[model samples]
Target chain A: MSIHRKNVLGAVFLAILGLLPLFLNSYWVDVLNSIGIYAILGLSLNLIVGHSGLFNLGHAAFYAVGAYTAAILNTHFHIPVLWLLPLCALTAGLFALVIARPIIHLRGDYLCIVTIGIGEIVRIALINNIFGITGGANGIFGISRPSILGLTLRTPTHFFYLILVFTLLTIFLFHLLEYSRFGRALNFLREDAVAAEGSGINTAHYKLAAFVLGAAWAGMVGNIYAAKMTIISPESFTFWESVLMFAIVILGGSGSIFGVLLGAALIVGLPELFREFASARMLVFGAAMVAMMIFRTQGILPPRPRSYDLFETVEGERKA
Target chain B: MSLLSIQRLTKNFGGLTAVNNVSFDVEQGSVVGLIGPNGAGKTTVFNLITGIYQPDQGAISFEQASLLRLPTHRIVSLGIARTFQTIRLFQNMSVLENVLAGCHCRMKSGILSSMFHFPRQQREERAAIDRALKALDFVGLRDQAENLSKNLSYGNQRLLEIARALGTEPRLLVLDEPAGGMNENETAQLVSLIERIRGMGITVLLIEHDMSLVMRVCEQIVVLEYGSKIAEGSPEEIQRNERVIAAYLGTEDG
Candidate 1:
């Protein structure tokens, strides 16, 4: 699509989304909130699985860490959940750094397997209540609702606005990151590690950074999730959650932001829409996913190649 | 003084010595060629120099700093950039982005600066883009900057690799079989490109089987046979050396 048309389409889409909560009932607004949450999570995962080409299937471990951190701290100390955003991000980022440091060098399927193990380990640890702080299988409860300027976010509509704003911020920041020197380095390493290394990119360092950054962002989303639900458990973050996030990125289009958003909508929102189908919904969803994979192997919206406006300068040089 | 120095470089894979007791000097601002038959370990030497594989016993230094224990990316940062024999371009990225990746080592934007587009980061990014474009222009691929690298012709892909390597602004540029699959016209263009690279005061080290192109562009030539250096001299001297000739064409007894 032309840049102008894309901008117009994006604006119209955002306007519709902005006004969606008013037209829909509470349950549907909550669904949009779910999509928003998944969209942010997918964007975070995209940094690793999409741009950096790291096979990270344990992303939920970071999310769980973030949620548990908030849940434990907020329940015990009565600390406001909103105040723990940065702290949650820190804990999750640090957790990723510790895990990824040793295993970042493993390639492809091996990395994927290791990440799956890590996800399971985190879930089991939460269940076992290793630190005695996680509250074991029952999980932590009564997370204080997030608030701003003395106004608590009590309803789905309130949380939707919060999620929408955060999602927009994520898209903006990630958009910048996607075009930055750092983003380019990640893409280069993803394409060909040896060539990227020979071209002066520190592959291991960049890979580790992507893991940490993606985890940190997911952690922040975990804080929002805890606040929205007001109760947290090991059940909320599972191998299945990580799989959904991964699928959202891959099925949506790995490297494109708009694609991930569209994917989050389809993956998260479609399942809800299919509820009327009862038992047949999953079969339809599965077949649809298979067909999409076969038809658009690159994703629903593959990222366009980057272009620069150097033509004018080049033409001027040629004339000169 | 030599720009890059290798002393007794040896690498063993299981029972086989891919490179053994090989020592050479690449003079500053000179084009040097390493020639050998198949499985003669020409690419292995490049790997060792670039730190892809650590030598079992050797001291490889660039500008007097040892590269023995350094990683491949660090080697490039210390002013050595290389192109692979198989043409390893970022196939899905734009031609310009491929070269921009080469400018990565020189860029200094951290995550926050990059995400926020701070003035310093923007300036550095603009400079990197200009440098990348200049490298593309040097290789005659400026017009294809926006195209995906995989969409480029095979010969153009090779040129794109060179352009990507040049984005590093390296003091020594290493190429593995740059003219391996190029037609005559492309090979001729490669010869002139190598000349222009040297003209810009960069030292070059290359491994090539194309003797005609090598003889025309290389000021110094090193010949390897069965993982050992057999001859080191000017192109004409290497062409006439008995062992070098015998290595290329089997001896009567053999």
Candidate 2:
């Protein structure tokens, strides 16, 4: 699609989403919120899995860390959960940086395997109740809803707007990053690390940075999820959660924002829509993914190949 | 003074020595060519100088600082850049995006600033594009800037590689077999492009199989035979050397 039309389409989609809560029933609205949360998670994973071309099956560990941090701190200190977004992001980012620092040096399938181990390790650590804080798999409760300017975001519409804001912010920020110098560097790493290094990009540094950023974004989303649900559990974040998020990124066309959003809806909403086929929903999802791989291997809305009409226009003017 | 200096560089893969006790210097703003037959290991020397391979022994200093122990990425930012013997453009990126990536070494905007689009970051970004465009113009790829890099014609792709390398603003640019696949016309364009790049005041170290192009463009030539320097002199002088001829033929007989 042309860049201009894509922007218009995106704006239209956002407008519909912005007005969705007023007409949709409570359950559907809540489902959309879940989709929004997953969208952020998918975008986060896309940074590592799609843009940087690293196979990471352990992303849920960071999400779990953030959710646990928010859950533990909010219950004990009564600090507003939303206020802890920065802390959530930092802890997850630092966790990824430290744990991934050693094994992130592994490439491709090996990296994927190690990340799986890391994710399992984090989940088990929470269940085992590290430091007597994690509640030992019983999980935590009584988490308060997020508020801004003293207004508690309690209703479905209020929660819709909450995750909506974060989703938009993620889209805007990832969009900027997709076009930024950092994004280009990541693309080079994705295509060929040696070539990227030859082009003067520090490939290893960029790879680790991508992991940190993706983890941190998911971590922030964890804060929102904790507040929205009003409870947290270890079961909520598992190896399966990582798999679902990775699937969303893949099914969405990895690096495409719209693709990811549509992917989130399909992955998060399809099962709900086909409640009669709840057992078969995963089978359908699997078939769809296989079909997508066969037909559109690049993803449904693969990020448009970057272009520079502006440069060509400037070149034209120079000649004229 | 030399822009780049190498001393006693060597590398081995098992029993075979790829580069053995090789030493060379690239003077500031001069075009020097390193030519050799297949498997003589001219590209190995480029890899060693570019920090892709740590020298088993000896030192590489660019503008009087040790290049040893530095990572490959750091080597580029230190004002040394190279192209591969095989084409290695980021095939999925736009042609312009590929060159813009080359400006990475010079661009200083950090991750936060870029995400936020801070004013200073915006300025650097614009400047970076302008620099990238100039490099593209330098290689006659200005019109093809908006196309996907992989879509470019093979000759254009080769030019795009140079544009990408020149985008790094390197003090010394290294090209490996740049004219390897080009036909006569493309080779002619490449010759003039190298001349234009040199006119921009960058030193060059090139490894090429095309002797005619090398003899025509290079002021000084280094010849390699079985991982060792067999000849070093002006193109005219080396063309007349018996050992150099024997090395090219892989035999001592007439």
Q: What TM-scores result for chain A when each predicted structure is judged separately against the true chain A?
A: 0.95, 0.94
Candidate 2 Cα deviation (angstroms), residue B82: 1.0
Cα lDDT of model 1 by residue, A103-190, tens digit:
9999999999999999999999999998799889998888888899999999999999999999999999999888799888889889
Candidate 1: where are CA atoms >4 Å away? A1-5, A311-320
Off by over 4 Å in 2: A1-12, A309-320, B252-254
Q: For model 1, what is the alpha-carbon lDDT of residue A27?
A: 98
lDDT of 2 by residue, B66-156 (tens): 9998888789998888888899998988888889988988988878987888888877777788788888888888887888989998888
Q: TM per model?
A: 0.97, 0.96
Candidate 1's DockQ is 0.79
> True interface contacts reproduced by each model, as a fraction?
0.85, 0.75
Q: Which pairs of residues collide in model 1?
A: none
